[model samples]
Target chain A: MADTVATPKAHGHVEHHDVDYLHDGSLLSWLTTVDHKKLGVMYLWSVLFMFFLGGVFALLVRLELFAPGKQFMDAETYNKVFTLHGAIMVFLFIIPSIPAALGNFVLPIMLGAKDVAFPRLNLASFWIYVVGALIAVTAMVTGGVDTGWTFYTPYSTTTDGSVALMTFAAFVLGFSSILTGVNFIATVHKLRAPGMGWFRMPLFIWGMYSTAIIQVLATPVLAITLLLLIMERTFGVGVFDPKLGGDPVLFQHFFWFYSHPAVYIMILPGMAIISEVVPTMSQKTFFGYKATAFSSVAIAIVSFVVWGHHMFTSGQSQLAGAIFSFLTFLVGIPSAIKVFNWITTMYKGSISLQAPMLYALMFLILFGIGGLTGLFLGAMSVDIHLHDTYFVVAHFHYVMMGSTAIAFLAGLHYWWPKMFGRMYNESAARVSAVLVFIGFNTTFLPQFLLGSRGMPRRYYNYLPEFQFLHQVSTVGSWILGLGFVIMAGYLFASLRKKMDAPANPWHGRSLEWQIPSPPITHNFHEVPVVTTEPYDYYRPFEPSVKGHH
Target chain B: MWLFLATEILMFGGLFVGYGLMQSVYPEAWIAGHHHLDRIMGAINTVFLLCSSFTMVMAVHYASTNNKGKTIMNLLLTLGFAGGFLVIKYFEYAHKFHDGLLPGRFFSYHGGGPAEQAMFFGFYFCMTGLHGIHVLIGMILISWITLRTMKGEFSSAYYTPVDLVGLYWHLVDLIWIYLFPLLYLVN
Candidate 1:
């Protein structure tokens, strides 16, 4: 690719660090690295490790739930399995997957900045997350938490397991989350390139900017909540312990206040990826660019109010419930607008079916269902019936797993070449995308029916009536696992191949793609003076292309 | 720095929300609980924290002006004020513990409605205890900045960390500003 030879500096593509980011390839470098790209890669690997670890726990959950009478593990082990699964997935994987991992890698380049405003703090955030994960592992080894990831009181307080360590782990992780948020916010505010005005930036920046706001503002609430919960369990503080006159329901309000906005925290970055992918794959500029950008901020603001909807069936006031239900509907508008905009961008454009495009399309369908189902739960009366059922489980899985996890995968596939300077098997990627979509639907879609048909979540055993759906869902989990295994195979296989990746493999209009496949240590030779809008596809993207993507 | 402070406010903001809800639920219990706290000591600690904030502001001011000597002096004053605040907190917690106002199941008070009183005391200890932890963290931060100031690492052209740390210290004081009223006083 000629772009690789369009040397911004005197050196051509021969500089090893220019095409790949392994640096000196020493343990010391990995340990003490402050480069945002290195930190982002570290975050990426750790989150993936956690994802598979959590996936194993999920498989065990599905295996146990395969038959109504408990196939293998006892009820106690079952409880611990599901709890560990939830805690691991939430804290270790999905929460940090997009924003901390992909955002850290791409946000700087997207804005044409050399690095985030606080590079040292970026390094510290990664270490803090590691420390927090270590604490959680210690808790697991000691006596794994079984109070559900929500850690609702009385059960959480009275549990003999390692609630204190686990909650403290979460509290520590909250600090990591906040530090990243603070760093991102500062970077967006102070580190944009000379000519990169706010609107001139890509949609991914807007999504990340909004996510950073929520991460900074909302994550701390979770920190304090967990701290109080930890204090409650360890010192027998009566805050969430009702036997000592504390309201457990009050704990619900506090938890969801953070956790709900946290839902957006999980999804918005995924939305950002979709926003980026649609423009590049469709070969068109973004539709409703301003609305799409502002919608992220709008979603962030509205997310806080809808948290009360999570507490609707938990003995909140009637007036409060009605208001929450109303506000919950309001939060959907921004998401609906984003979906509409993505489709509109694809409307008359020369859309191509690429690997990343396939995942983006899948995300559109899956996330649409996820958001629409949220409306069902948002309705007060419907939520009352489905509150603790598998329905709620399925609903959130649609949002969390179906959307966020899938989006993370999408972003991973989309940027894998740029990050590694290697291209995976395109056909294999497309097949994996299909398997993932089908397998995911097969796994979660049945659970929704089981939920509606009166299957309670967190059940160690169930009646024979719910067995068929459970079996179907269990089969779906295997297919889903197979999809991931195939994905891992091709991704790893791509690493060993000799074929080098083109810098602009996807013809992406973003700054990250315009540079070398794997960008240099400092992203640009000079901080790029941005003179064009992102996804300026109206301009001839490649007037002299060697070959089309 | 402002973004970080916003997080801190939201963090303590959550705790205050919890405190507010619990207080409203058990008004008489909260009323009964606040009495056990040493109001005069609380007032004094508040003054100490306020003075610390002022000193921190002065440290930033001096650092911005590139006056390393005055910056160090004001930082020392801020640390001294934080120390004074901790000393009063020590005595206050000591009095409560001495009077058997410990947390949860450890509460040995002979008062009626032990559960309700424990609930209030629970919030009291949690709120003040969390605040106390922040003060300790703030002191450590201040000491670090003090050493940095003495080492002449900061100047007018670049005092971002000093200015940021000052923002953090003010947030601590601001949280205490609310914590004092909510935990130490009631009509």
Candidate 2:
């Protein structure tokens, strides 16, 4: 078989090929771009900015907790910092980072489609995220939301801060999530290349598809929840307030109904990236590809039923608690299945210790710890003891920040060449990858210990007994922050001082490698005919148009 | 569009679950509150919505069959039904306001325990008000399609936008079908 792809002979190729998507940069062109790549890169930068912004708040929180006796800020300021940190990270950074940013760039191209089915909607979703984020910032500026990210009722309603404004911001952000989910679902359904069938699609698409399902299905609950919360705060609706004959616990139900599935929304895409990175680096067909792909859906489906597990300690019925606890365990099964399959895929396979691969490996270990810890918290009896503890906090940060956000970084490093048409310093990438791992584990591992020892989460001041662990955690945050800073420096340096990257720099058998680096305005010159399996390592999958250069 | 509807279903699902849970918790309060709602107006609104849905379906059919004039007319008729539903809603709300049946803390109806009464009205107003917002959104979308239809943008080959909008309007109708019995005739 010819290693080179059939050169697309520019058959009425009306588009100008002289300029890459990056060089044709004008503010208006960037803003009005319906091009998936440009929109994707923009999502990348915008979301990364949000990630660091959240990081800053996180550092402040850690600094405040460095010695436990309110280092500099007051208790109220501490509340605002952690709330904004959590809200900004979850809504603005983690949820949209991988799927909207990296997935937007890679998904269409990997499918060999010209663009997503709803390109306009993709752009609109990004802009909606921006507007929603800005509104949240406005809420923060107006007074700062003190209800924490969960915004539990009664307290949330009575709070003096900009609760209504913040909840409304979250409400608006739900539209962005829903729109993106809708777009991805439509694209995956309608826009696959001629030969790409369901199983032939990338696992990332599977992760994204399942994620989109959860996003569209679950996000609206959050929207309605926030709206009701706003109503409760602004107009004194009694649904969540006990004084009005409403149940405060019911608010927890509405919240976790969306939020628990929202956990899958945050992690699924990261798993998707790992599915890609693991296979590419290992040079193997993913071990149990069907199982791995199906697991994403399984995780999504199981995610909904497990919402009650979060409410176990909130005075929910014991029967409901036992049922939810069991469901939560079921959710872990699929996640465990994915982790097992990834490891199995790597078994006896040719391995490349690339920056992306390192991150994938980290995700494997970190997500494992996160998932296993979930089992501890899922056991109703055990959860009662660990409930609202730093252990729970550490568990989620490990899953969300460790697994999803790490996978985001991996995908970013993996796809950077194709996105920017340039190569980053691999050694610096490797160094920071390890730095992030050390930093992340250091920051959260102590929290788990502190949690087991009865250190509560979101506590402004701690007794001297827990001071050592808190101090260790605080110092770890600095390392994590430094790791991220190093990443920023290297990635920015790649934008200027680097050689142009080849399309298939990693030599993986995927459709994205079949396109030009920093792909043209249109991803493909013609719709590709994808005959081979998605991961056929025996033959190098050539670019659809080998003669583009 | 179907997926977006899935989200809408869940959004309404939250409110419905809240209503169900609260109703189960305070059955007497819910029953007493339900009696205060005008079943006649609720029925009228339901009729108006059902008729609008039929007209909306007809418009989609006409647009698909390339009957632009009939499509525009049906759309306008559907819009009329939508507007009529809103007008009736306005009356119902005005009547509630006059009776001091406001939601939450402003709820002044003291016959069936103010707190429980307020909770009932809260769900009623929140659910209906939210649905009303949906109705308004459906109207805006339908009117947009109407103008586009007038300018000849759709035909049998490309009536997807019309079909999608029809689906949304149908969801609105469907939600009211549930709301009518739940809020008005809570037997």
Give the candidate number with the greatest DockQ. Answer: 2
Residue A50 lDDT (model 1): 99
Clashing pairs in 1: none
Candidate 1 per-residue lDDT, tens place, B99-155, comes to: 888877778887655357776777788777878888899889889988988888899
Model 2 off-target regions past 4 Å? A1-16, A540-549, B110-114
lDDT of 1 by residue, A36-150 (tens): 8889999999999999999999999999998877589999899999999999999999889998999999999888788899999999999999999999999999998899999
Superposed model 1: Cα runs more than 4 Å off: A1-19, A541-549, B111-115
Q: What is model 2's C-alpha RMSD?
A: 3.4
**Which number leads on TM-score?**
2
- Residue-level lDDT tens digits of model 2 in A1-549: 012112223331224544667777787789988988888889988898998899999999999998858679999999999999999999899988988899899998888888999899988988988899889999999999877899988899998989898888888888999998898889999998888899999899999999999999999889888888888886787888988778899999999999988988999999999999998888888888899889999888888888998887898898989898887777777888888899998987888888889999999999999989998898878888999999999999999999999999889989998888777777788889888999999999999999999988889988899989988898999999998899999899989864457666677767777666777777777677778778777576544444453
For each candidate, report its DockQ versus the true two-chain complex.
0.79, 0.86
Q: Each model's C-alpha lDDT?
A: 0.86, 0.87
- Give the worst 10-residue stretch by lDDT in candidate 2 chain A: A1-10
